[model samples]
Target: MKKTRFHNKYKLIILGVIILLTGCFGLIYFFYRQSPARGEESGDMVAGVSAGALSNTSFIKTYHLRDTTHGYGLFPTKDGGYLVTGDTIAGGGMAAPYPYIVKTDAKGGKVWSRDFSSQSGALGYLSNRHLGRLAVETSDGSFVTASDVIDFVDENLKEIYGDVLLTKLNKNGAQLWSLMLGDHNIDRPRQIWALPNGEVMLLARFLKTGYSSEITDGIPEYSVFIKIDKNGKVQFSKKMEWNATGAERLVDGGFIVLANIAVILPKPAENIVGPEVVPHPLPTMIKLDSDLNIVWAKSMEMIPTEMNSPTSYAGGVMTVGKTIIREAGGDFRVIQAAPDGGFVAFGYDNLILTQGMSSGGAINISDKDVSLRPLVAVKVGANGNYQWAKKLTVNLVSGGSANDFHVVRTADGNFVIMKDVAHDALGVLAAASAVNIGLIKTDADLNPLWVKQYSVERSVEGYGLWPTVDKGVVVAGSMQTTKMHYVMGTSEPYTEAALIKVDVNGDVGGCAAVTTHTGATLEDQSSYLVMQDMKVMGSENLTLKINKKVKEKVNNAKSAARDICKYKKSNVTPIYSLLTSSDGSSPTASGQTVVPSTAKTWAVINYENAKEVAVVGEKNQVIHAELLPILNQVYNSQVKMKDSMASMWLAYVFPRPVTRADVEVIQKNLEGLGYKITGSEGGDLWVSKIGLTLHLEFAIQNSMMGKLEVRF
Candidate 1:
């Protein structure tokens, strides 16, 4: 007796037929396609263990993300977070500069990272700046770093070009100030430090006039240490004829200076003997008084041995040394410098150069810049006597590829270092044989108090350092599931984000590292190492389900073409109404039934129906939804029974849990041509209405729109 909308638009019998078909399709789909989609991600683990390395040097935990940026100018913060500066891979000019900064929690997990130089490549804008050394903390709790800018312009702002870009960031990663260093290629900063008198000093290299062209410095390079007030006013500045690599403020408020001298050996002497002539690294050191006057200067002797690049700083000197590194098993020197001059001190073992076939230049000499070398830490006593010496190996040597550490003395009078390790190698190799960082805490005596190592899953090495904090050691990494079962194949390789927390004991622990955004389709290799977290942002099951439905739709058409092809006039187009997994676990679900939205599909045999194309297609979809309750036999469910497609439509719905057994059965059933099945519900299946001239699918989402189309 109820006057339905279909009643007003069609004859009573046809309207009844429409409602009945809708009910039948709905029932058919309910029992077939439709299952919940959800699961957890796993990790791959290798053999081995070392409790207190740097990071996961331990073999237990396998956590790590593949797409995180390696932190440059790494520093740990007070609140247990890290503040790093680097450029996004997308904007990075390879060796060129494109400035950006990232802030991560104490655990090396990113809170957020932003690129200030996204426009570095826009129009005429060709370059930006990369961060150098970090200076002292400001009165307001923020800190500053020195760097150089190039062809930079801030729209609506006045300044541009090679200015010294001084930036101050808060504990929460907010930018508070940006001070430019130069107007053009004339000036640039090499190092920076904080003064107790509310002033900041920068140690930088400057070029005389006319050096602005791509590569020429008229009067060679002079190093300048500049002092500026909190307001950016230049209070005093000094220039050293030679180039300085860095500058730092000593504990006593004085400054430490790092300089570089090109040790030219007059290659002609070497060329006399062979085709190749080897070059070497020189030693450079300078001591500047408060007024930026050069108090003392010195140069290190040519080590004549392997010299690794290890950066060092003290009251009036900055040093860099080398050690046995990477695959190159050779002892390197420990170079140092001070106010009076430089010391080409020797450390590590010693390099042994075996005679090789004659090749000239670049080959014989061992130096810092060319190899993966050992890292050295140096501290000079007030009286100039060396106070202490230390060298880290094992995890520090080969592991340097993955785990780098930051050494700092904590307020508690204890010293702690942070490192990273790769833990998942599937026993193919020992975790230690790969990469891992370790945090070794020692007493003021430098005696090992406790050691904790953290390891991650991926990265032949492991997750790069995030940041370090107080309390325990904070770190972050990522992980993923290995290959799918033996033969079923894999839909995708998924990954998740993780943050690791360690107690003083270095026991297995946890923290907050939400892995909400983690998947990305690899469309372009150029964009492989993305700076942002991965782009996988949807349900994993949804992907397979949509694909499954499409396959089902395809399966049905092929079957119809084959089944009735003998009928000659029988159209071979497939019709889709229900969904089923080829493996049968059609109605996939855990708790709530996660299923695809309901809809219908059909092919137009004639274009006339094409005008009604949109409408005609929708009717079948509604019928499919309507029949869900009926074919599944839910009487109380809202559905009108219709035998309209009874002639060609055969309904099948998965009622219970659609398991592996079900998948096998369904694959066999749909083996012939023209059989289309959809698991509207994960793990569930539903057959399509018969005789569709075109193949299509039913897709529904957050909105109320339903149409015959491919499942996305």
Candidate 2:
């Protein structure tokens, strides 16, 4: 009887212990659901966390000033700010798009916003699209934008006619002048360059005759180059044969234009049915003299038709004396001036296929189901001779392909390419199609250094990229969000302008691991193409009209467009697992390295290889207390620290180039905080308080770049 009683007591004790353990796990899971860890889902952590906060310079933000907004171009200003050009549409049925521009400070804070359609009387019409693809800052600190505005619309809300519009604004966002050029046809601006003589050069695609849809044999297009003065006067206008896509100003005051020409292939590629010959579009580069005369022209060759792998040709064999035909469409999209006085062009190659005659003498073309496409990069010398070509093949796991791409050379002599990859719901098992931005950094030889993919939103398209002084990059684009349309009584996708600033490692606070791509294969195909001379037409001056301007009230509220639009910060950080060497081997170490506590310390450690010194007393706490107030006043600036065995000093880096006006403002702000200027020297000022001393120094790197450094 006593043994039975003891057994019952032990069973009760075990039951109580199990219940306690179960309750503890339940509470732990409940708290985890409330506040999950970073990089668990979207890889986003809330800002301002003291434990693992991001650097003050890194940010990912979306701005919605209207119902729908799209960012097309981004340019850095001399004042360390940025200018964004895009279009915005109202929240109504069949609303027309208006050219929009926004200027922001270095920290991505909006300074001023303008909608040209609301200001100009010429733009007060319902149209289909108004696309502003390029903007640049002039030597005088003014801004200029080139846009294609469809001003005429039919009764069915269809676009009828389009014109090229050039608008200039002062540094304060005030309109200086506006001009429109058209010939009663579609005239789209392709590129604009600011000259050193306060003049601007514009390249446009002009439809000379015939409707774009009705042209079947050849595209009835002409390349128009116009030189305009600062006062909005057209100095000269030159016309060329084909449609121009890109242009770059040579160092010797000349220019190089990238255009497309029709080329007819030889022999068995001809159609067997008719006497008509299909002309394939080929990219050609034309160099122009300062007087608008053609110097030389070079056409890029097609990718070779032969492949080492048998499956690439779909098991078909080439007949004797028969050659494979090049694809019908291929064009270079971007042309950038290289450091070696030459130019680098980037584009995609056409798909491969072979044409032959069947047993019945009919045309038979065998094509393979290619899931990958090669992105081509070509380099040419200053004399317009081909230097080298590299091909990159990207395997899209989302079953999509690359869309738009931009390439820029970094300060470190590397090239960074930003490309958009489209993702379909059928392949990704999502609700809709989306686009993710991909960044690939390559060495001087076009070998891949690293590749990363960033999904900022469900659908995002990057159109502009600029490298920063800190070796990082900023990407500006448009992201889509779902919004309820009151009139349509349904939800529709809305667009907002997105700007992302990442560190040198392409990190945005938190990142997750993803699949990596091998290095891009490089092949030397420089001997395939030859340069020839092309014809250049005469130059003429065209008339320009000034449009009326009306100032609109700037809205600064973040929730102003809440009802009609949505803004989203990026939740996912890009992965950098694809870092590789020139020999296509993975690196043993990860691409990321732990940076020092401050920027000055990091620079010292990297450049000087200095050892770290620990703080002796409560000096760090005292320094933080004294510096927090000053930092709060100049919250937009970046702060770095210099630590030594004796003392620690804080350095404040101004966001904009330092001017007398900026210095005076800082002095006033500091004086309000109990600091007084004690002495002054050439481009240097000293301020002091009861126990603190501050030094302000203005240094100029070049005629165009300057910086302000503050030490205390």
User: How does each model score on TM-score?
Assistant: 0.40, 0.59
Task: Encode model 1's per-residue lDDT on 100-135: one tens digit a residue.
Answer: 445554334456544443133311122312224233
Q: Pick the candidate with the highest TM-score.
A: 2
lDDT of each: 0.34, 0.53
lDDT per residue for candidate 2 within 1-712, as digits (tens), equals: 5544543443343334333333332333232222111111111111211122223245666667667787777887777668777776676434666666788877667787777642223342322232246688886778888777654322222256666777788888787877766554566776788876567888877676523343323458777788878877787776666677777777777887777766543442211211222234557777778877778777765322211111111224322221222222233677777766677777664322111111111222111112233456677677876666655554432222233567777755567877765342324233124666667776555655565667654667778888876556778887775544454676676678877776555655453222334434443333333233434333444332223222322223231222111222333322233323323443323222212121122112121222233434465456455554655455353433324223444333333334565556667776877888897655677889887786767542211112344555
> What lDDT, from 0 to 1, does candidate 1 have?
0.34
**Top of the candidates by lDDT:** 2
Candidate 2: count the clashes.
0
Weakest ten-residue segment in model 2 by summed lDDT: 37-46
Q: If candidate 1 were superposed on the true structure by all CA atoms, what would the RMSD be? A: 34.1
